[model samples]
Target: MARVPTDSPARRPFMTAVKVMLYAALLGLIGLAVAVSITYSQLPSYQTLTKTNDLGQTIRMRAANGQVLVSMGPSVGKWIPYDRIPQAMRSAMIAVEDKRFRSHIGVDPIGIARSAKVRLETGRFSQGGSTITQQLARNIFLTNSRTFGRKIKEAVVALALELKFSKNQILELYLNRVYFGGGAYGIDAASTRFFGHGAERLSLGEAAIIAGLVKAPSNYSPTADVEAARGRSSVVLQSMVNNGFVSADVAAGVSPAEVKIQKMTRQNNVRYFTDWALPQLDTLIDETSEPIDVWTTLDPTMQVAADQAIGRNTPGGAQGALVALDRDGAVRAMVGGRDYVDSIYNRSTQAQRQPGSAFKLFVYLAALESGMKPTDTLVDEPVTINGWSPRNSTRTNLGPVSLREAFARSINTISAKIGQQLGFSTIADMARRFGITGEISTYPSMVLGTSDVRLIDMTRAFASVSNRGVAVMPYGIRKVVSANGRVLYQHDAAEERVLVAPWVAAEMTDLLQSAVLTGTGRAAQIGRPVAGKTGTTSSNKDGWFIGFSSGITTGVWMGRDDARAIAGLQGGTAPARAFHDFMVKAVANRPVEQFETQVPMPDWQLEPGEEAWGAGDNAVEPVLDENGQPFDQDPYVYNPDATAPAPPDPNQQPPSQLPEVSVPPVRQQQPTDPSRRPAPAGSEPADDPSQSGADLAQ
Candidate 1:
């Protein structure tokens, strides 16, 4: 309490220390102000915001008839500008992403205080303190890494952004540039990718679900994981209600179904086709910024019919695939699997499966092209090549049968004998000529279909057979036009005559007709003159039916994805039945015309080898010159001295009494109604015989 005299030496030391402290504090304030000014100056000006990359418009796809199939792009969709965003959606986004979005300038001090309090009380960091403007600043200009330095930069950038632009403009940039999961980058893309429409059309539930994805896109991607997405959406709905964006009753009543997210990209039904066609897009044109409108040959009615037919006939837990092509080789309908979301593997064009007896069309064609006629004799018995003995699926062998009978019954021994006689290389060549690009085994067992091939290729080959032996290349797209109406690509659709022999084609048609009528493919008859073949693989693992009308050719395959045997399933059963049902619906509106007169005797019948046996057997009788002598005889007549390998006759028995065993064969049976079969299971079946082809080799 002693009074210090003026200019005392002891008090002077303390006064000097105080003056130094004041000068240091003044210099510190000036430095901090300069730093803040410099940080704000480094930010991009609002005038340059409009010029920044505005790349968020969806790539749209339309079907052949102008039906909008899908809209997708690199982080783009219907560009719903800030002015057009629905009021409900806008409110929902604000409530879920940043509740204090309207009140805060750039960063929300109140939100930060609450978040800090929660973290301290809970001993966990759960809440984010960034405002909508702060998020927009980070998203557009800064990386999303979490660190103190980065947060400081984010806060500075957010303040700078707020000072440069209006609140509305900041909100607009955030909504238009924020990532929302899937391939969606903005609210517009999120709206379209999830709801299949513009953001303006978003319902309350949809807006909440999309808004919920901002925190973690992958964790809430509707397509990648629907349940997780729904749970996140419920949180958003509650937030919306809490923030007064929606009523509590409305939030509680929101059903997940009302917030539909596209289960698959683009449209639902045509994803298989679109996925298959997407790669072809880049091949058709160089890199393009604008979307290209593609016109495909997919017949909507036929596609529906094919889908329904397979769904009706395939057995439980067994998958099936179908591909249909018109005579001109345009793919009319293709169903790769039951649900594309469950699996995207395109069985129609990607999966390779053993065709079973369906492959015999090539073997029989090889026989015909190798100078063997339907009237020629083929011994259906055990056939051995290089110590590999191939037996009939029926276990019994028919003594002597015509090529036509062997083909109709899908006689494996006879087919093996013919393949050995002509060599499997010839059969493989024939298959390749008919558009089967996959590898074909040249082994004798290959005559019984020991190789794998895709359904599309098989359908194309069969279409060739139906198209008068003019081999066809299956194609889907008919035209591709740019958004500006420029023709980027158009299918020439010119028929490439790969195998151009009318006589052989006619003969094969006659034989296949026998297969449909009084043969293994009896179930495929559509109350009209139809022809097809039924094939059941070893252990009943695979079943296939491939056939064609003069106008359309189709192929169907059934089997479990795990290659498990379908009990009592046979090619002549479910697959043939599906073919019948599909054809019945496909040709309903079209006229049922008889198969072209390419064959002289469309319904000619012969008893194995003895000659004629049916009503129209002699319709095109040989012309007789004088004295009833025959003229116009075929040059490749059967000769006793020919070096061709003899047909197998291991057990000569009557055709009816032949042991009908299953070994991937065309076993004939009067198929029951298709209604008794199980519903289709998966998308497609692949080829890997449950029992190896060596089972026959033994």
Candidate 2:
């Protein structure tokens, strides 16, 4: 009877359907095997992963004062033995991430079914399909890709991990390798980054907050948002109550605010410094499967000063960067842009711009090295090299002026003449000697700093001058140590290369002094005999003030990122003022430093029949009496009988000149002190701003 009905109308269709189901089920099993085999083949070698550090590499950066700046990467936090792990942290982890973490082999089938049912009922997933073991497996051996293939691989690896390691071992790996917010990896790092302590010391509240972060670290990170983190913690607490990890009364007692989080000062603009420095590990050490602690030369105080200075002084819609270096070229402070949130591009080390008159340092150093004295007279006239005619910013032809006079006044004509005399190759070589490693154009215009240069490089070059001629290599990392306290790298303090002769540095410092004392950098004056130069490129596209005070060389650059000009912006204005503000605080604790050995710089006399070029925006010549004489002399001392000039115009601007033309400020007024005056003239007048305001560094 059974055989007769086997092929009947109803039975025939059922028999075919059973055959098809069998084939499909067989194919599905085969596909599952292939996926498992492929995932196992692609898995990283885990024999070395006996402990928390087996899978990740972390980098921890600190300031000179041992202040932890940032701890990032897979293994950033502390790694304690299994017994040392906090019970509260373990309870919180199990409560939120996988309540059945201890009982499940790897993937939690019941949890997945429950979550799927919730998703169907509520139109949203209330729990993740993956368990803690699956997450550990994915984080260790897979990517976060949400594709079905990745999910298959995740499950396969989770089973492998559960089979290979004990229940406690799997939990240890999962707890230590999970990602927390703010560059923290592992429960220890998350605890340290958020609570400023190791995971072993985490309280119930702190542990719960951290456990909640596993769902969406960035969205619920306390460091990223306050209310969002609190909200997420509330959810985690309810999860603990639901999972029976804690009673509802116990969960209710856990207040998010009761958990003390560390101050967030480390998350500021100093990230610019860390971002620049982290990549250096490639050269400093061999690849390792452990975290590293990098103690840097960053000075927290100086970093703050630099940030505030740039923020307060940078013009609206423009960006500014400041790099301060020790005399030996250790970077102390760096501000890459106006704000890190607005942009991550590090202008200090990445953006290359013309330094304008600041580039004159190379030409003059080359000149001095070639035996040309600061007192040597050079004609400030139209001179063309390779079809490039160099003109002063003031456009007033300063006939013949001494080297000191031309340099202090930022005389583009004389600087170009010096560049011509020494040859562009010679100037470029000098720049290289002083730590400018980038491509320097040897073109005639390059003599006037037409070639691009990084702000960090310029600051380092000037550091050589302040270091008394020793060459500088601007560096951030001072020491690197592994997690096991093995010394991986350390800065060489014995290496010192001379970039210039002491006499040459002294001579350059003398000219720089004249610039602040009598020329375009008067705004940088800080009630002391500081030396620096001001630079403004054509159309005021780039403004620079690189100077040395108390052995600290700071280079400041302010301009639009697109290289457009800011109206009324000059090196002597925003950049110089920022420099002043930074340096004043930077050197406040340090004793005043003077150029130890200065080459006797003469008050170079103007050539006969040629009057002194009036000071531009950079100078404050001594006020002279009612003589009403056209300013013709360098008055180093204040003149008693000079008229008390009216307060300068608030909107006073540097005399606008054509592009590529450099000039000394032609306006002369008494500078109660210069540059603080809007007219570029002061009560204790220098010469015309045409002489003082000259800038070809644009």
Clashes of each: 9, 54
lDDT string, candidate 2, 313-342, tens digits: 999999999999887678899999998855
TM-score each candidate: 0.60, 0.59
Q: Candidate 1 lDDT, tens digit per residue, 259-363? A: 666756334556777777666776776766566677777777888888898889989898888888888888778888876777666788898888887888899
**CA shift of 185, model 1, Å:** 1.8
Model 2 bad stretches (over 4 Å): 1-58, 73-266, 286-292, 481-487, 597-698
Off by over 4 Å in 1: 1-60, 73-181, 186-267, 596-698
Model 2, residue 693: distance off in Å is 18
The lDDT per prediction is 0.73, 0.76
Error of 2 at 505 (Å): 1.5
Candidate 1 least-lDDT 10 residues? 675-684
